[model samples]
Target: MSSSVPPSIPRQPAAGSKKQSAETATGVTKRVAPGGKHALTETEKRGYALGVELGSDVARQQMEVDPKFLMQGMADGFSGATLLMTVEDINGILAEIQ
Candidate 1:
């Protein structure tokens, strides 16, 4: 019988990968109206995102946020890590954009 493994997954290891031995980083994409007037006007805001494989040892709620959403207009992303701000600043992320 064939191993029931996903074909898209790679089984090799990188010499200098930062992730754990069993975990791999997954990328996802999402597209959502930045939280602004439009976001309030439009009930449904779509978000595109990538997946980060946390590994089999733990349980994770899988979700994707588009890379574009990580831009300056959205959240303050730096050095690959997304930043969080106070409710005031966060709520106005896309305020100027739209």
Candidate 2:
């Protein structure tokens, strides 16, 4: 299935590639607001910043968090796209983590 999420926020990196730092990975800071078109509004920028903070905290705690999968899940949730995993699968994973 196709995603509405922009390519800048990739779902995954190419195999064998080193993971980038959060700033470079997200490309949020480097993004230019182009004539207000495709530009994130103040609220959207704030939300993304907050999400990054929260995700960072989660990563610190979990240590094994895959950012690509996290981004894909968030994008799916926000875009109302069909999730990659079922509710039961999610619950099972959460149960395992717990």
Candidate 3:
């Protein structure tokens, strides 16, 4: 006699969706790659968070902001300064911006 159980179908990712969400069910943010290609490298995630924090600080200054220019400036600054900086140093910079 044959068994009556059916096979399970595999699930597939949606079309054109290359990366999965970086957050967890507990509402913690998982760091995805800077460009979302794969798992986040430390530099990539730090750089992104630095940019976001600094950009928000700038926005609160009420100046006209160009996002591309702002991001490029932050990238350049981080490239040179990150190696020599601490989180406190970065926070000081953000605090002094206003």
Candidate 4:
């Protein structure tokens, strides 16, 4: 009896590498918008500023309360409203918070 096994094929270059090379050769690039990822409109900027200002006021209100309250408040605020925001944007904001 004769065995019947097909020859294996060699692997090609990675698709990602090919894409990167193509992009480089074509002078194609990507970058954050002037403001950042998910650039906020003027209205969004006003909302963010108001939210921060209100948070500051609330922080003072919690001077005698547990610190956890403030943390929970921040978590709630971030979770509740995040229009026109991306993970990168949120991370950058959190980094500034720290």
Candidate 5:
């Protein structure tokens, strides 16, 4: 499937935005800074939590995953940005691991 990147990622809010809302998993809402910089939305928060949990699992399994690449892949996937690697590349990596 094809997808396009969003104007801004969760970590970086769009410029000139008045306010950004941050809703936690517990449903608590808070306003970000005046410029709404470095604020994450509810979806972003959940995605981050899930990412952390999965990362922990990978660590527990003693998997040697590069944090930089893993984060980049997650960002690309979430923002619909062009993937750094092709499907075949990913398959080949997985095959090697297997």
Candidate 6:
């Protein structure tokens, strides 16, 4: 069995690009250690819901709107959470059911 993945998962940029997409002090490494491995410690764990479809450009376009960003804001703050996990899990379960 195999797992499908996102078309592209953006790579965590090079060390020089530390501040890029990082929610932290401006250009400062948030880690206490020299390597700066992790930015922040998890304060909580949370659950999520997701919907995915491979058809229809219109549907995809609508999903890109920012109105939903607020609804999804810090709700995705949990340690191990992502929008695609739910999609893949549901697909795997359905495949097994069939």
Which candidate achieves the best TM-score against the true structure? 2
Leading candidate by lDDT: 5
lDDT of each: 0.35, 0.65, 0.54, 0.49, 0.67, 0.37
Task: Tell me the spans in candidate 4 whose CA falls farther than 4 Å from its real position.
Answer: 1-35, 63-98
The order of the candidates by lDDT, greatest first, is: 5, 2, 3, 4, 6, 1
Every model's TM-score:
0.19, 0.52, 0.35, 0.28, 0.49, 0.17
Per-residue C-alpha lDDT of model 3 across residues 1-98, encoded as one tens digit per residue = 22222333444545765544465334444444345446768999887666556555555557776665455445555465333366787689759765
Tell how far residue 74 is off in model 2, in angstroms. 0.4
Q: Which pairs of residues have clashing backbones in candidate 6?
A: none
As a whole number from 0 to 100, the lDDT of residue 93 in candidate 4 is 68
Residue by residue across 1-98, what tens digits does model 5's lDDT show? 33432343345545775666776444545455574345789999888678656665666667998776776777787678877789899899979876
TM-score of candidate 2 to 2 decimals: 0.52
Write down the worst ten-residue block by lDDT for model 2. Answer: 26-35
Q: What is residue 44's positional error in candidate 4, in angstroms?
A: 0.4
Candidate 2 on 1-98: residue-level lDDT in tens?
Answer: 46644444534544654543335343333332324335788999889768767665675566687666777888887888888999899999989877
> What clash count goes with each model?
20, 0, 0, 0, 0, 0
- For every candidate in turn, the CA RMSD to the true structure comes to 19.5, 8.7, 18.3, 21.5, 9.1, 15.3
lDDT of 4 at 46: 83
Best of the two (4, 5) by lDDT: 5
Error of 5 at 22 (Å): 24
Worst 10 residues of 4 by lDDT: 17-26
Output the lDDT of residue 23, model 3: 50
lDDT of 4 by residue, 28-93 (tens): 342212324367899998886665555455454454434444445455556764334667886896
